[model samples]
Target chain A: MTQNLDLTDIQGNIVKAYGSSGFFKARYLFLRVDDGDKGRDFVGAITSKVTSANEKLKGDDALTVTTNMAFTYAGLQALELPTASLVGFPSDFVMGMSKRKDILGDDGPSDPKYWDKIWQEKVHIWISINGKTSDVVEERYQWILQQIKATGGVTLLRGHCGEDGNGNAVDDLPYQDASVLYEKDGVTPTAKEHFGYTDGIGDPVFDGQTNNAARVIGRGKLTRSGDWVPLATGEFILGHVDEAMEYPQTAPRPDLLSNNGTYMVYRKLHENVGTFNKFLDEQSKDYPGGKELLAAKFSGRWRDNGAPLVHTPDNESKAEWDKKFAAADDATQKRMLTDFTYNEDISGAKCPFSAHTRRINPRGSLEYGVKDAFHTPGALVDRRRILRRGLPYGKVKDETSDKGNHGIIFMALNADIKRQFEFVQQQWINYANDFKQGNDKEVLLGNHSSKDPGKVVLQVEPGSGKPPHFVNNIPRLVETRGGDYFFIPSIGALKLIAGGLVDPT
Target chain B: MSNIAGKAYAMNVITPIPWYKVWLNRLIFWAALKIPNVLNGLLTLSLIHYARWVIIPRDKFPRLDPSQPKEDLNYSYMLFFSNFNGSWDQYVDSFTFAIPSGLDLFWKMNVKYPKSVPLTPFHNYIQHNQIDTAHYYNAYPMAASNDVKSAKNVKKALIDFNAASSNKSPDEFLEDYNKLLNQLQNDFGEMRPTPIVSLAAQAVKERVMEEQRQSH
Candidate 1:
């Protein structure tokens, strides 16, 4: 039976976007609590201020104040909570990000000296504030800072800056001092990361959540006909039955403490935009279609219009692209945003299996060569889905300069960190055996180890008798600046912590 | 009353493996058997010898009983481990419903040592046990190879079981159970496990070849 989700008990940012129009300015404030009693008092003060999942703001110019918060394992320990209560939490979360650096393959950064300073500090609490305008965001930001200060907590990191004058980021921002602000391109009006691909597409739809748009287009080959089913809610929430049909091992609780809570993997990924552009410019010289087509092949989407390469193989004429969108109604257009699957492109002729999107999601293409391949193509990928809520950080100042902190503040929510997030990062993105292709890495997001220096091979299917596209000696495009695992607890859990009323028994 | 015969019998029994023949001859001769009686006595002795030397010993030390429930067994345990340098799904599927050669060696150890039941029952028991283990890991059993939906349905069943188990009262559990039944009917409509031909032996053979290559 589908369990009813208590939306009010969940954090707002987890279930839906607070800034609905994608035009709002946001800031992330990382904090460290010096006093346990004061931290509890601070939590008590902010419990009512934090937004609930029930309140979803809409409209292009709606000015609203929304604050969502999360805390690290250290943050909870700093609050004088019983250590026993933290048991059953994933080791990755308990150890925090710095200790799990080896497992994440973030042991060495591209600029190790620069990251050395970045890893010295740790953030205990993360408060995210989003408002329609910069003015509103600043107002709430200042208010949150004052609240943190009153509770004997100091701000560890404060980054606040909007998109560049050209609706992009300046390339030379410091990795630690700034939080890259994400906003839609003024001209295109679509949210894009530094790489210019349409961002925030293909988020998984979970049961009992109001957001169902992904269901229309994101259903894998597992679904038949009109039977659109959302993934089990437990995949993203604690105290709920997960895909495994059992409640994931969770932190100790009186049902109220852990229920509706979820774990957040907050990553600060610094993008090497300059190197990426240069690579594309040089590598595409001998290619058939040049840089634009090569970029599309890498991302699996056309940069300008976000048209999937699988659907539109070549860059369509502007008029033809307009006609395609014009023909679809509002609902159909919305569904078209994330609706396509790899069922027809099983051989990856249209979209290379190593493309960033194909590696991360795979959709229905993972069943090939696996036992019972025909029965359920989506089975392999279903357990690995994560609720992604991320935005680009830093600005690309000089597209030619490879020395910037511009990238994504990659955020993901999941019930099982190991099964969902880490599985995709390690097995699917980094490893090549599961795809039945040779040893390769994801073209865009994969961390190409310096030791092995993995290659990216795109198989452009037969009939032309052309050899596959091979790019050798690929450099690591993204660097882990710093990251930490956080627990976004329910409002009830927050109250319990704040009041010091949690019963250990 | 038979002092003379008892002394002769004691003396005959003192010989080693040959004492069996001497005892048999003495019994047959002492009974004053005719040709038919001698033939019947020899046949009976042969049958007794077979039962004592083979069947009783075999039954005394049976192989590991995989069918024995977890609660019943006091100390029987076995651990299986394998390292596959390839895909996890493929590796797990390779061992499904079939014992690999290495495992088969262990399975057949009882033939010489005589510790467990017959091969067929033990194999069947392991196969059934494998299905439960697969479900624990949220994987489909080999028998349901063609049924892709079985894994998802098993997950749903587990969810339902957990929900019912959480209920504090019989009424609540019944209510949850009824709701789960209705959900199964409505969501999946009707579900059944689709049996598929076992390719377990083939998978095991492939694994064995791969392992041999790795060793070299």
Candidate 2:
């Protein structure tokens, strides 16, 4: 029998509560079992026992279990269980959604004028389980892999950062698997993405019932704390949502949201360190200690405040930054510089829209409630989040190194890859007029591949009635390489993969 | 018994115990518990001493201890070292109050001699100089001297040595020196924490002078 419990006791929620500030690092692993019978057996054994090992494994108290199933070529079926599905989601899931609404759109072109300025595309990865290879499976695998490598792991082309360890640009270095590891926690399997920023944060939080607030009663409705309910397994895994069937997204299925089925996307994007430094140097020439200013602008906080927009380089001292309220004293002036929120300032004057900080999280005015906020199409955000798991691949090279290489391996966990992550990349940052308000794109991470020299304007002051200064010198920080989608099976699937397939004996 | 064909075989065989393996397992088990405790205890004590002596004293106002010797020999056991006053304290804290002549010897050992050399002052400074200024002259001249009684020759020798060591001309040396001095003046003159160290020293000096005054 199934037991009902608050999400607070779940493994992911517990981790989030404790992980508030200290080094926020996490790794994600994805695997495709060779044999279904063995995989199912392996997965089942671990899931049945994993709950007791939560504390030892640094997971939350909640033991997660779900089964996502899909069809392979020639009617062969498969199943997966994502880490996000097993882990209780963090509050940031909702916060990130609200912020995403600010920059994205539900339909059509977002910023029409800049449409020609930048291009946003996705790469996908498809791997064929081998030795026992099927032609249909191989065809799908090559197609997806090629796509990912070509796009930047959005589809599946192999992409590595331009520079290599010896400092020479491997003009021909093909994108490949960044890194792989052995057994996790002795029995579990896992994988790491590039770029080291816990990729799993991309996963979304879901409310179990169809009606989002049906589970919560009266007073708890609007509160952020009240929103902390365990997401339904269907939100992340495919067949887990609807136990009876499979192929939820296909034409023959009853509903688009499948049971225990999740679409995952992985990518490896290279950050141009040399280009980044040049941009910082050029931008900060006018300011004293301009490098620091650049650092503040990119990080969104002085090394201390840890909040990107709330703090700036000029007001780096502790006393100056701890301004929760306006002060009249000499100490107050220093504190006033970083005392406001993004709600108070929508313009990219203080924090550039395309900056890594802004791209990672642009809160406030961009949320759902604000005017001009983009409406995310189709699936409500509750079912559309992804878990990002990637790491830095290749040796970090210095400017003098002739080898151009190094980049992040990016991964995301979502019920629908096309609707969630890919949608965000294409419709929000890359698609002009997707928001229908202005031609503004997140200039930093946004792709400006066109010849017109990708242009983005930033308002230096909020509501100052002055025109935003257009700065065009910013270069690409990340480039897509290659990656693939893999199903992390439930204990049942692990048993199937480890044990003999169809153990009729 | 039976002595037929292959009969006379031993029925039971005796085997020796693996005593060392047993002992190793026991040692590991005991060490697992004891080693951690010992290491933790050491760490705790070091932290406690650091907090009690360094952080706490600095946080709470510390009074200048003139009567106390400059060096606290117990400092070797401490985890926290005073960034600046540690070496100075090592000298002044070892001062001898019983002998007046010890003051002259103290200056000669700590001030005139470099840190690498052994610090043994002359046995009899009284015979060398009765007046304080005479002692200063005797010590300073020699400390600055390659050979005694030739200040002019010493200056010439220093200039020659500097030129021999450097690949650049004298003009380049002066230019570089002046540039470095300018930079140092700009950076250290305003930003240096030297004033804090000097203030600490002055506070100690005042306490010593006050004691001397009271005695007088």
Candidate 3:
């Protein structure tokens, strides 16, 4: 009988939905192992153990990392199904993401730039084992950590190596690793990139072994007592049961049920904040405080999740905000959002047509005309969900710095990439033409809003069905430096990674 | 088996049965093993990318939207979406939510009909098309006991029906609906309203057209 292990149950502690402060920003590292045989042998030995543990733990079942390994055993293939077709040989610098240190500089004792050094980031261990045995992989993995401890602290940086147009060995410089946690007075806002906007306002709730009854009230309660159903925990945190269900191949053992989570995909996405700001400043000449208008166009809400649909400059009242923003029962919220045809807010009266929130979540309006509209089924929304983890990398240098490299290491997890992150980016962010009423893309990171090379709108005009109006703030705020997929195994899998295979022991 | 393991002698040996089947088996094994290896190697390369020539190290990373309120979040995105519930039944049995209790008798006929058979007579359709609700309920081993009971009732009723009798033809099923309408009309007598089936049929017809256009 074929045994395929599912790895979706394992939850990442810090989900991106809830806002992050510090200590939790994502960092990335990429590397490439030399020999396919050694790497494959290494991976197979390690992955089987990890996935098996995940099978026990009920973790994420994506072969994001292993499929790219040098050699994959047929047995392992039987376990994991390939979603994305492999294109070519693996590169030397395979990448991984992580959280930044207390500060964004190299601070180890030996090298003044130790924290930023490339070598320090790598988790290295020596393995002299072969075969497709899970034991060998686990042993070597454990030994590698021990080796890291034996050696004093070392910095590992990730970089790329390829031939240039002239066939020259083009090796990009190693990135200086550092976290945004130590930025004094500067708040590392737990926000999605570019627009300086808050995201993941509402997410599905999940109920597992933990007593999360407090989180469920009103319409939040879907299933009865001990009835398995989906729940929304929060953003940037682990998601709900329906979300988790997408990743498994079979039922997970009860012992591995609690808190076991999945691996995260991390990438550094660069934002052209300066260029975006300049464009918005140039276009919105008619609006009073055009920059703020620009911010409104892209963000949909004025920095505080407050929508412009309800509040005008003359009528920006707290009572109005409160009246419009009441978090009612889930069914009410669902009805209010779903039953609408045009953008829920007509005339862009409350939220603009092109706000980031509406672009990513569009809650009700996107599915308005479709069949089975009321059922916000998993198939419809799973593609919209992304496991966003990562943090702001690099510094402003000086506040007056002309250009800087800063961006988010965006991460996502889903059973089908076509349905989840890709669809959201292609269909929603880039192609979504309708908003609360109609028309316009998110001004910040969306394609429609960024159409004009020169104009950057912080907020697009309401119901205009045009690109976001430009705004000025920072330029090139983030950039897509690089990215890669990975599969994090359960504790059992980790043990397999640490233990070398045994000959029928 | 013991003798085979004991003597590690010949690399190749001939079997009397057939060469083609042996060759086919070898081809299948090699293809299964080699293709995965090639794909795995290439996929690993995608991970080894760089931004400005720096290697990104692996470690614990963040997940989900980092800007929403805590109360709004139930669990992490990965946990919520991943296998946090620790079962594959949810995914496998996801399609079992509805099992033909409504007036739309011929719903989900595609699943019942195949290319070879084409279509079934209307009365016979109900028996062959009867949804085994118990089978659907049993699909999820972890489902609640109450759900299992209700699903069993639906299954028993479906299984007991004969294909040649009640649901033998499409026209017969429609006739049954008409009979029910007449009964309702007579029972109510005082007040009557138009049935919902015709409206559904119209809507479905339009949707099929739209689907055809989209496919092209």
**Candidate 2: segments with Cα more than 4 A from true spot:** A1-55, A59-234, A238-261, A286-289, A295-305, A311-319, A322-341, A355-364, A367-384, A399-405, A432-440, A450-452, A463-469, A494-505, B1-216
- Show where candidate 1 strays beyond 4 Å: A1-3, A59-63, A110-113, A116-118, A153-189, A211-215, A219-221, A224-228, A316-322, A369-375, A449-452, B1-82, B86-216
Q: After superposition, how far is residue A294 of candidate 2 from its true place, in Å?
A: 3.6
- Could you tell me every candidate's TM-score relative to the true structure? 0.68, 0.40, 0.44
Task: Give one digit per residue, the lDDT tens place, for model 2 in A408-470.
Answer: 655565554444464456434553221221233445456544343354543345334333334
TM-scores for chain A, candidates in order?
0.89, 0.52, 0.54
Please give the distance, in angstroms, between residue A406's alpha carbon in candidate 1 and its true position after superposition: 1.7
For DockQ, candidate 1 versus 2, the one ahead is: 1
State the lDDT of candidate 1 residue by residue for A354-452, as single tens digits: 787788887756545233322244645667888888766566878887664577778899987766787677656765444644336677877775675
Best by TM-score: 1
DockQ (Cα-based) for each candidate: 0.02, 0.00, 0.01
What local lDDT score does residue B128 receive in model 1, on the 0 to 100 scale?
39
Per-residue lDDT of candidate 3, residues A25-82 (tens digit): 3213333333323433444443333322122212354221111111111111222222
Give the Cα error of residue A65 in candidate 1, in Å: 2.0
Cα-based lDDT at residue A374, candidate 3: 22
- The deviation in Å at residue A260 for candidate 1 is 0.6
Residue range B114-179, candidate 3, lDDT tens digits: 221111232233334322222111234222222233345445544544343375577776554444
lDDT of 2 at A478: 55
DockQ of 2: 0.00
